[model samples]
Every structure is written in structure tokens, then in C-alpha cells.
Target: MKITTNMHEGRRTEMYACGAWNDMIITDYLEMAVTKTPQKTALVGYRVHAGDRSAMSYSELDRRITRMAAGLAALGVEKGDVVSCQLPNWWQMSALFLACVRIGAVCNPLMPIFREHEMQYMLAHAQSKVVVVPKIFRHFDHQAMLQGLRSELPDLKHVLVIDSDDEQSFEQVLLQRAWEEEVDTARLFAERRPSADEVVQLLYTSGTTGKPKGVMHTSNTLLSNIRPFSERQGLSATDIILMPSPLAHQLGFLYGLMLPVYLGATAILQDVWEPAFAARVVAEEGCTLTLGSTPFLADLVDIARDEREQQASLKTFISAGAPIPGALVEKAASVMQGTKVISAWGMTENGAVTTTRPEDPQTTAVHSDGVALPYMQVKIVDGEGHEQPAGEEGDLLVRGASQCVGYFRQPDMYQLDNEGWFATGDIARKDATGYIRITGRSKDVVIRGGENLPIADIENTLYKHPAIQAVALVGAPDERLGERLCAYVTLHDSSATLTLKDVTDYLVEQKFTRQYLPEYLEVLAALPRTPSGKIQKFKLRDMARDIFQGQASHA
Candidate 1:
């Protein structure tokens, strides 16, 4: 599926002319590093519990990527084919993406947290030809799940499992042999070098109000953000990146995996978020930079305060997906003496569009998201489409080189205006100096840590319960995670009872992701509704906030 259009061509020309896009695919960068820094450490993966660590140099990693590409080709994967991978932050996950680039195929990375509920929709919608998963991750049998799903998805022809030595294991099939030598190297490069405009990533974002839409991005669009964003942050080949965020999310994919490759830098991957483990790794590796959500910073601060030596080598921490509280920023600065905590805001549609600068006051991130990167534009507009004055909260909209091409197989769902602006569904205010402060979301979303919960999907599932007559999901205040999901329900019969555990049990039985289950449940006689009978979620949100505040005060 080619995603290019006249509009895309026009954008590409504009971006290239202005140097927002350098017109180089990620594989080109990998090859450049292979020739220039062949012996440099390109990747370091840590599997803490399994007591395993792997490191690969640039040249060795490139060779492995080529072999992996040949393995995919041997499985009948070709140009434009979608290859989905549901793996953890292991070395193989990073290699798989680069291999997709080598073979000119679209790569779709699914979060390991996703179960049959989300996988069924995403795999079938993307029409993936190949899916790679772990034999078992976190005690869940991923191989079994995919095997069960295979019969339902006719497009899924191959299921390759990682962390296993079986016939279908990724290492056995893709790594044990030198398949690159068997393939016609000259013809493979000549026939399969993908253009920068071709869609390289298909990321399905958890929706706030509807089914997940597959966000499609090309090399030019993704690299557009990486180049300027990294430059502004003063990242270089000398710096080491310690990434604990999930590789499946854009935070880890763009920065943890792609950014290091782009800069010829080293990336240290941590598959799980253990603050003590992360702190130790950063010090041991001398990692200089990292990016994650507010919760990560909070946990790191807690650890650094107790073990100051663990975070001594850290230089930068960029927080996104939620507002950074001023108190937390102060605490982090106090504990990690030289580390700069930068604030940023963006979506899956576009990578980090705005971020606080290193030279700015430490408090700037507390008050505002930051100024837009050079290649992007941000504006706040009223309901009538007029630009709002500074300090006035309005709809947040953004557009630029980093904006995704369109939604996969759902062009009409993109809904960018004629001028190329995309509505962000966020309400925010812009200062006279252009920094934006996110006030609230026009869309109902519960941002637990850095992940957006699928509110509509969860609510719809709850509606199927025999006891529920009405249900509304809202985000409740939480200092560490920014927000925790709260569910308010009205029972079918006045005497019908419901408890938080009961609600969680039902959702789990329905295959809902455990991490997204509501932390609090409220049983009400009737949900607050407007005169016209529409549910007033704002009222429920306020109630949740009041209850949370009360609990905090009592404690």
C-alpha cells in the first residue's frame, strides 16, 4: 500500500527545500555508521531478571539486520508488505525494525501489553503477513495466543517467536545462518531500496473515543522530528541514551532506537521500568540522556535521593505525554544535581513538536510545554476557527514536516484541514512568547503514566455487564502517574450491587488489558446528565478529583 499523494509530494518538497527532512532513510544512517564507526557499540540490551546482556557493534548489527531481512524475504515478505512485531525491548525488536527498512516493508510494532482484544483488530486491519512474538513474556504465552489467532486471520502467514530455540524462533530462523550470502546482494539493494516517502511505520494509538486508528509515518516525517529535536536537545554521538520506556511506543522507538542510530550514538535498553535498576544502569553505562513520562521522572527522583551516586552521570531527562508538576521538577533538580528535566508535548501523529530548552529556567517546564521546534507550528483556535489570543485556552492544533502522512486504510479519518493543520483534541493556552500550557483535553482520555487508555473500548465492554445500566470512564488525579482511571456506573436494578473487584474481573474476563483497569469505582443511583439526557462526564471528573483530594488529605 503506497501512501503517497500530491499533497504528500508537496509537503516533501517544502520540507526538503527548507532542510526539515534530509531525505535519508534509517538504513542509510545504519550503513553510514557501519563504514564510519564499525567497532562502536551500537546497542546494549538488558534483561535484568534473566541475567542476560547483549551488545552489538555497528557493523555486526548491520550484518544481523541484513540477515533478518533475508529471513523475512524467505518467508515471502516483499515490498509494501506489513510485518507486525509484538516483542519487548530486546535486541531483536530493534533489529526487526531496521530489517524491515532493508527489505522495503512497512513495520508495525504492537505493544506487548496488548492482548487478544487489541491484537485481533490491529493484525487484521493492517493485513500483516508476518508477526514476531516472544514464546512467553511476563508469564503470558504469546506464541500460543498468536497460534490461536492465526486461523482467524488469513493474512497472517508466519508467526516467529523470540526467546526460543525452536524451528520458528527468530534466532534459529533469522540469525543462526548466513542467509545474506545466499541472496543476490546487488539485485536486493537495486530492487528494494525504499524511497524516503514510503510509509515505514504503522502505529495504532489507543483511542480516547473510538477504535484505534493506525498512524502511518514515512522516513522523512519521522526523521524530520528526530533531527531538529535532537539538535535542540544537544544530543551527539558521544552521549549514551538509557531508555526504560517501552520500545513499542513512539518515545522509545524515535529516541531509544532511531535517535541513537541517527546520531551514531549508543542506546542502552531496559525492558522493564525498575527505578533502582534504571538508576544503576545509568551510572554503570554513564548514560547521558533519556526520555519518558512524569512517572518515570518521579521514580528516578525517589531513587536518586536515596542513592545519589546512581544518577551522577545523567545529563538530561525529557518528559512528555503529561504535565510535569513544578514540585516534582524541583525535587528532581535537587536530587540529580546536573540533570536537566525538559518538558515536551506531542502525539503519535507527530513526534515531539515542542520542548523546553536546556538554557531555559528550570521552572519553564512547570508552567509551559515549551516553544515549537523549528520545523513545526502550534496554534490555539476558538470554536469558530479564529486564532485565540495568548493566555486564552482553546483547541490545540499543529502541523508541519513531522505530521504523519495519514491513517492507514482510513484516509478520511485523518481529518486535517485544507491548510494542513491537525486538531489535537487538547485544550491549551499559548503565552505571548509561544510556549503552550495544556489545560485540559477536549477528548476523554486517561493518561496513566505515558500511555493513553482506551476509554471508549473499556466503557463499551462495561456496558455488556448484566448489572451495569450506565458507565462512564474518567481520569482521576494522581501525583505519580498524572491520572488514574475511574469508573462510575449506575446499576440496572436499584438494589443491584457492584464493586471495583467485580468490575475488574468482568473486564479481565473480556480480555481488557490489566494495566488499564480502573483503580476506583463509584456506584451511583443515576449518572449526572444534562437536560437533553447526555452524560455529564465533567461532573464525574470533578467528583473523582474531589474524592482523590479527600483521600490525600486524610492520609
Candidate 2:
């Protein structure tokens, strides 16, 4: 495929590459997988009693990807076009992603849970040409929602509906025979493939602003992370991958789909977050490698405890998005049997930066977030952007191949310091051995159960409510989710009071997703502040924790 760099239609490869992505692209890996292991179990999914329902071989997946690419071309999706997909971990998504790279279109995967509040900003900003959504996922009517959003997104020409009753059916259109008789599928596939350095993925991450930031990543940058991370854990084609995390999230996006293709392994998809189902999939599919948040590991441990013998063939479990405690690691080995629990740390811009290797001591995996991958560099920095000494608790910055070139539409937002370091906005410390430990986040966002809540956006939206005089959204400590959002609000009048129901209703009207709505509401007479008139968020966090846990609010 011809190279398309950054947020535009045409740019030189040198503009973004720095010096990578010359030899191959993402689809090349799938091509290699098919060539090397034509009959190998390439993809697997679902843990329904019916068995591992979604399973596909290497050649079978390749054929589907080819057809889907041609089908997308028939639907007016050209090179450099953005195809936005908001889907669950269905078997079709894998083919769709491969199809995008094959047809030279950018793959934009949005969270299935993203409501109009999140979708509107990203879709419009990206100027996506074609959008694919499930008819109904988890009781949400995405088909109707995208249809309603059409007027707002003028560039959105096609809205493909998955498993639906319509002329524009997702499966019927993308996976069926070539739709356009004039176009030859073979020639189209050969000519439309993208360069390895082209911006193949246009993903969105939560930002300080109400809107989401679109992060652009190339095939090389993404593979740089996956190739090393998987190799470090000794992943192979024989391994079965159980992907419990949502494919929309970066963790699942890299390891869930791309990593499997890279390994030529079978990937089992669990659409929903059900621990029992996840465990069942692992056992049935003989899943060996999986990566997700700490909560996932915790839930799986609980699920394993009920079993007399370990049925699952789990080898490595890399828990990320939060810290993994020592207690959980010891318990996992006993209950999960053969599974080795590891920890990882990274974000949307960089896929998997640091990960505890299979060789590291179990204790190191439990405490530290692990050493940086070969494709990247990690260092702690002070407020003035100077590199901090080892063991100094300061801001964490990472630079290297796995990092995204820039943010889509908002290139200015992708700022880097003089040394090419990108501030992670996370306060962390690197040990003398190069292992990093995350202390806290400087960004104003609440990462609940691995889903990032737009703290500033929610607070700003709530402030518009007439009854809310002052509002601060802070993450209160929680065992399961790591942290839960709590809204500390002061009413306009003494008689006016805000309840959880009141805040939920107000946020709902603002088009915020239910997941982002605060679970607890702390009504305060006045918000505590520093001497200089800045809001003391630390004080509010304490109050939120106190109120949420049924303790008395000191304020």
C-alpha cells in the first residue's frame, strides 16, 4: 500500500517513520501466518455451553479477509479512508480489521460502550467515511444511534449493521462475494494494501477535555510492541489466546487481535466481562496466553478456586491497567495451577511498553510494572522535564518505536519534549534494575475497572446543572475496580440536595455513558481549597473515600 502519514491523505514515509516500517505491514503478518500454518487454528471465540463457537483456521481467515477487503472497496471505501467500527469481541471484527489494512483504509475501533457523548466527538473529528456497528450490543441499539448520528457526520457515507435485517448488512456486505462486478478482487487486494508505516489505526483515548483524543498508529509501531512482548513471554503458534478484555481497548486491540495474527495462534474472544465464561473459554480452548487488567486476574482466580483440577492450559497471564499485588500472585499460582501471572504497563499511544517477563521472579512481577520492552525506553522525569534519578518518584516519560507518530486531527496535542520524551502523565519511579513502579496519575481521569472515565468532562458537564454550585469528580478507592468515581457537589441553595439518581439523570441527558456516571455522591457545604484558591483534590478524594465506605465525612 502507498504510505499515508499523520492525519492527512498524503505524506512522505520519513515524516513519521524516524526509521521503521520499510519491509512489511500488518496484513503481511497475516499473509505469513497463512503461508506458514495454512491449517493452524488462527482464531477462536465464545465460551457458550455450545462450546468454543467462534473458531477459524489460518487459510479460512485469510480468505475472509480478502473477500472483506474487496467488499469494502465495492462500498466506496477507498485508500486513506477511515472505517470506524464499534463492535464487541465478535469473530467478524478480526476479519474487519485485517480487511482495513488490506484495502488501505485506516481501522478505527471505538468502544461498544461509547455513547453519543463519546462517539460524536471522535466520528466527526476523524471524518470517517464508513462506520460499522452492531444492531444491538448489550441492549444498546447502535444501529439506530449511528443512523441518528449521520446528519452530524457528513463524511460518514456508509453505516454497516452487524447481524441485522437490512440491505446494508455487515456480514452480508463485507464477508460475502465481491459486490462490485467491475472490480477484480485479486487486483484490488494487491494494489490497495498499505505501507507498513502508514497510519493503519486511528484510535481514541480519554482526554482532559470533554472530547476524546484520536491517536494515530502505524503497523510497524504497533507490531514493535506485540512482537517483543509476546516473544518475551515465549508465545508461539501452538498457544491459544483467551482475550477477555474488550477489543476496543488498547490492551485487547494489540494483544487480542494483532498479537494473535503475529503469533499465528488461535485467539478466543469473550465479548462480555463474565469470569466464569472467561474461565470456561480458557478450559475449552486450551488458552495459554492472555493479558488484561488486575480485576480480570482476580476474577479468574476466584473462578479457578471452584475447580478440583485445572482444565485450562493457561501459561501466562499479564495483568495491566493497574498494579498487581503480591497476595494475588501467590494465590493465582495455587488456584490457577500452571498459569504464570505477570504485570504490564502502557497506553493508547504506545501499545505495551513494559511487561514482567516469564523469567522474572514471581515477586518482581507482583510488585514492579516490569522493565521496558526492547522497542521502547522508559524514564522518570521531574516537573521541569529533567530526567530524575533512579528510584525518584516523578513523572514517567517513554520514547521509541512503539509510540504513535501523532494524534489524528489534533496534531498539536501530540507534544514531545526536547529529548523526544512523551509524558505519560503518570507519576512513577524506575528502580536501579530498570523496573518501573506507578505511584499515581497526574491526569484528571478515573480509570475504573480498566475503563477510563472522563473526570474533567464529567465535572464540566455537571457544573452546567443549575442545582450544582460546585462539583469535583475524583476517584475513590475500590477493591474491584481499583478506583470508583465519586462526585462531590455543593448545591446552589441549602435546601437543594443532589442524590445519585439526580446526577445520573442529569448525566444521561448530557449523553454520558452509564459507566462514567459517579457511583457515589458526596454533598458538601463547601469544597476545601488551598491557600492560593486552588481546589484541593487530595482532600476531596479523602472525603469521597470516607463517604463511599460509610465513614463520616470530616468536612
Candidate 3:
């Protein structure tokens, strides 16, 4: 077994003493649900591609976790080893995560869309002992891809296949029924459960830098994130949670799997992201709360607009991972009544840091990212690391128990400064009452002749335009001015294509400063985005270098 457990023992003790880190681990709560309400519905998962619906009771889930754990032990998985999986929102993922905790392995869930390049870097970083991949997901033969790279992944001892015609099927090997009959699962698990302070999860950042960084979090740190949202929202066993986001991401994992189990609530998982299908599941399953990125919220609202009957049960909609346009927030009240369209901001390093309260003033959601959650703190700092006062745009920093422990296998690279705060690389401002408004990325902003162009403000302005469907503002390379703002826009079907003049005219009407106005406009079929739906601005920057250069070069 690898020694990846509890690297920062002093930090854990301090957090626990300060009431930031609760002593309870995740499995303890799962077991509580098992013991208290064994027959209660724990999960309802839909695999749209396979045309199947799977459900599990608390008792059944408990047994499956046990069996899977025993099976993993038999396959030579041990404490502190990495159990990497790339799956959709499936019941097997839920079981596999619990299975990992049962034997004290770290869970490293890769995005299903990740091809060989990302997989190579991450698998090598984690030194993953086992990797679970879909046999064929979204028409890509994942098994074949991994099989081709097996020689390169020296630490990979086993490959568990999911949903395929293979001898080493995940269901056949790990999740086989009645493993306790052959082995002492309870005893095996009892001997292996990791402490709450030990690193048990690895979530990779979809970085602009070529390689992704694996952000490590212990049980205490993760729970510090979940508990705040749960308490603030008053989540309980009665609430039904719906997840349209990828479970591999922290947003889905926290609310989809961990939160429901922690609260002993029923969680509904939708594997495929069809807005219409998502609406049906919400109605049919009586889902109350959903948390996802801005696009998911938009899709849900679009479906709710058309399919009125499917939205009656939804109480809360938490939008994160991207900026929430003020227009989207204002549209929500009338479009989807009786639901809180809460805006939030967070990262893989810091789980759900700031979030607008469900009962927060309507304008707050439209104007600000959110207020800091309990035990999670956020502050703005100047360039020299001095804390900036409210209403001044500066670098955002966070220090709290919920923050990630460090980067996976690269502790030295996780640069927490002398004050124990992690630099968030976001330019933001806090209101007098402590609401943070994300202005732009520290690295993503464009400067034209020593003046910073308001990229996010321009994007938000363009989003409100009737003709534009989606918009991205990138810093185009300019030799003299250093950089210039270039707007890439996608037009709505109902509208005519917008020219550079049309875009500038709209921004002018919106009262945008001439300095921040887009110098060039490029129409794109779609904005290049990560699989999780974040706009890949770096790609846009590269594309910007080739456009409208002669005008800037000669002038």
C-alpha cells in the first residue's frame, strides 16, 4: 500500500478544533442511511445511451459497496492506491466510490471525454493501480485506447471495463453479487478505512496549461464544502437531488453522490445531457434541487419554458462553473417561478466557495458571484499580497478547511503563500456587505496599451444582445498595443449575422467604454469549450492572432 494518507496532520487537528472540519467521514453517513432506513431509495440513475434505468435502495447500495470492496481487495487493490475511473452518471460510479473508501483507495474520476493525451498525464501522475473505462463511450472505443497505451502506464495493474462485451467487465468483476459469502468484507473494510484527514480524492483542473493538475482533497476538506451548502439550504432526507453535471467533476460528486448520502436523501442521476430528457426526469422523479454550470441552467430553463408541466417540483437551481449573466437571473423568476436560480463560483481546488443564498435578494444573483460559505472564506488582495478593501477589483484568494490539501504527487507545486491562502487567479471585487463579483480572470484578461479591457463585462454585454446566442472575448495579439479585444460571437437562428459595426453599435448602446469595445468581431459556429462546458479562451487567443492583423500592424 502507498503512503498517501494524512500528509498534513497538524492542519487537520487545527481545523477540527476550530469546528471547520467535522470528524465524520463519508462512509459513516452511508452506513447511517443503511442502518436507519435500509429500504429507502438511495439512487435512481438513467443511462440514456443504453436505454436503461437503474435504482437502488439504501440496503442494496450498502451490500453492493461491500461486495465491490471485497472484489477490489481480491484483485490486489490496497490502502492509499489510486482507483481511477472515467464514467458517466451511472450507479456503478456510486458503488465504485464507496468501494474505494471501503478499502481506503483514492478516487480519481477522469472525464469520459478525455482522450489518450490527458489520460497519459493524469494516470502517470496518480500512479493509478487500476483504471476503469467505458468500453465504448460516445462512439470512442475507450477500451482500445487504453489497451494501446497499457505499456506506457507501468503502474496500472488492472483495467476494469464498463458496459462492454469484455471478459473483465466492471459488473462481472467488481460489482458481482454476494462477495461477502467468499470473503469477510466487514473485517476487510474495518481494517482499511482511511481517516478523514487523509487524501481520498483527486479532481483534475481543465487547465489552459497543456497538462491538467490533480487537486487533492481529504474527506474533511470535501465535507467542509458539502456541509455549508446543506446547512445554508436546509437540505434533508426529504429533498430529492438531481445531477445533470458529469459525476467526475467536483460539483456533481459533492451534491450528486456525497450530499444525498450525507443527508440520507434520494439522488437522481441523468447520464446523458438532453435538456428535454432532463425536464422529464425532474417531473417524473419529483426532483427538487439541481446544481450545474450556466449552460445546464439555461437548458433547464429553456425546457421549463416549453414543457411547463415538467418543472413544478424544482425548488432550487444552483448555477456555477461559469459566469451567470444578469439577464439569465432576471429571466428565471418569471420563466421558472418558485425556484431559486442561485449563482455560485468555485474551482477544483476550492469546492463551492461562494454562493448566493436561495432567499438572497434577486439582484444579488444578477450582480454578484456570491457570499462566502460557512468555513470557506474569500478575500481580494492587491499585487503585493495586501488585502484589498471592498469594491476594489483585485486578485481573489481563499483560505479555509474545504480548500484542497495540495496537488496530487506535487506538494511543492501547490503554492499556498505564507498566510495559508491559495491564489484563485481571478480578478474580483467584494461589495461592502461581502458579496463577491467576478470581473475577469487574472490570466485571461487582455491589456491594450497598458489598459485592461473588461473581457467579462463585454461578454455579458454581448449575451444580452438579441442577435447573439453565445459570446467570447479574447485578447488578440498586437505588436504595438500588446493586446486587443476580439469578440467571437454565435448568432441566434432568429437573427441575421452580426457584423463588426453591429456588435460595436450594440455595445455602444449598452454604455460600454470605447477602450473596452471589441476592436474586431469574428463569427464562430460554436465557442470551443471543455467537455464540462467551460469556454476554452486559450484556444480563442490562438485563433485571435490570425485575424485582422494588418489593420493593427500598419496603424
- Taken over the whole model, the C-alpha lDDT of each candidate is 0.90, 0.82, 0.81
Superior candidate under TM-score, 2 versus 3: 2
Report the Cα RMSD per candidate. Answer: 1.1, 3.2, 11.0
Q: Cα lDDT for residue 31, model 3?
A: 94
- Please identify model 3 stretches exceeding 4 Å from their true place: 3-10, 444-555
Each prediction's TM-score against the native?
0.98, 0.94, 0.81
Cα displacement (angstroms), candidate 1, residue 507, comes to 0.9
Which residue ranges in model 1 land beyond 4 Å of their true spot?
Answer: 1-7
Candidate that beats the other on TM-score, 1 or 2, i.e. the better one: 1
lDDT of 2 by residue, 1-555 (tens): 233334332222432454433456778888898999899888876734335476788999888787777788887888988899998888778788999888889999999888998898889988888888988877889998888888999988899998787887887766566553556866787888776767888889876655678888888788777777877888888888888898888998988988888887888888887887777667767788888887888888888889725545888898888887677888887887777888889999998799887888788877799899885899898888788888899999998778887887676778877656789889999988899999998887788887777787888899999899989889887666778888888898978767899999999998888988888887888899889977889988887777667743432
Ranking by lDDT: 1, 2, 3
TM-score ranking of the models: 1, 2, 3
Error of 1 at 216 (Å): 0.3
lDDT of 1 at 434: 94
User: How do the residues 58-143 of candidate 1 rate in per-residue lDDT, one tens digit apiece?
Assistant: 99998888899987888899898999999888988889999998889999999999988899999999999999999988889999
Best by lDDT: 1
- What is the Å distance of residue 474 in model 3 from its true position? 4.3
